[model samples]
Target: MSGEEYRIGLIHATMNSVQPILDAFQVHAPQVTLVNFMDESLIYELNETGIVTRNMARRLLNLVEKAVMGGVEGVLLTCSSFTPVVAEISHLFEIPVLSADLSMLEKAIDMGNRIGVIATVEAAGPTTKTLLETISSNKQKDVIIQTVIIPKAFHALQNGNRSKHDELIHQKVQELNRDCDVILFAQFSMVRALETLDFTTVPILTSPEISVKSIIAEITKRRIVI
Candidate 1:
């Protein structure tokens, strides 16, 4: 917390949901602590169960407790899947707890015309899409949203083989560029792979950059004196 600014704890269910947000946040916050919850195994567990587990919920609380011990001012959960746990953790902590999806979904409602959400894991399909639709409906925005998946590329990242992951991302972007106006890199690990993706014409958005900005803006507007 050396920055003297408020610290926002980042809770990541997996590295796939951690890196990009942390990468973007480091530029904004020097005092942040990232709490990781899941391994690559959790992705498969999500696919198998069609819902998050009790252990997932427990780890989220553990991460927040650890963050508090480490002296975090607030917390941000990076996974769309484990937000149920995030909500519960928010009630325990005195400071703010944010879900990575909330702000961007707000933006999609406010400004996005045709939004493209791209996550690398196949299991992200139901949760991500459902969140988008729900947000759009709540905002009452005339938005068109399409969900995209790059499982092979994400799988490479999960295995810690970034070289292969970037390669797959390059090929995928070449095809996606034709369809999307803006691309949302939904996973945090995908941040490293951004420069590797070919987006000659379309602008790509990393969730960390946008989500962090939205959080900051809300803090400013509410003047939440952290």
Candidate 2:
């Protein structure tokens, strides 16, 4: 690390599939160090039900505060289920802490009126539903967000059958494509799998692309401010 080097902390409120998350930063943010923290805080609830409870949201914020203390220029949490948690943290921190989901969903807005959300956990599903409803309504636009849950396969990922996990996702997207105008993967771990998906006629939006950009922009913003 040097004077010009940027240090970033990525908080994963789950034991997130880390390979692609690291790879994305290496390519998109070579000068930045991507320090990571794991919080399987929502694992059971998410896998069983697909909704992020308020209690889980609190842990996510606590992690962001930890990242800030680590001297990171910015923090980005990779799970979509914690979007609100990210927002709540950013409001408290002086440094930038970004919502990976917020950046990714911005792309979904451009794709069309009907959004298809494919999620691995229970918490992400309900949080995404609320996010879509709030944003679409704020713009005076409407969207029909169709949600699909892959709890079994997500557990497979947790237990280490990554290949099986990816295959299940590909299978789910095939069906998801038939019903909505576009597709949005709800987790950062889903990106590597998503890149290989059939993609149908709809666009497949992964958070990493937007999230990496968001991180870079925020890091650069803080550098200028100081």
In order, the Cα lDDT scores of the candidates are 0.66, 0.77
| Clash pairs, model 1 backbone | 9-74, 20-188
| Candidate 1: count of backbone clashes, pairs at least 3 residues apart or interchain | 2
* lDDT tens digits, residue span 117-186, model 1: 7767665656667777887777676666677677778668778899898877666666666776666666
- Candidate 1 TM-score over all chains jointly: 0.79
Against the true structure, whose lDDT is highest? Answer: 2
Candidate 2 lDDT tens digits, 3-57: 3477888887666646666877777767778888788756666555555667777
Give the deviation of candidate 1 from the true structure as CA RMSD.
3.4
**How far in Å is the alpha carbon of 94 misplaced in model 2?**
0.5
Q: After best superposition, candidate 2 residue 95: deviation in angstroms? A: 0.5
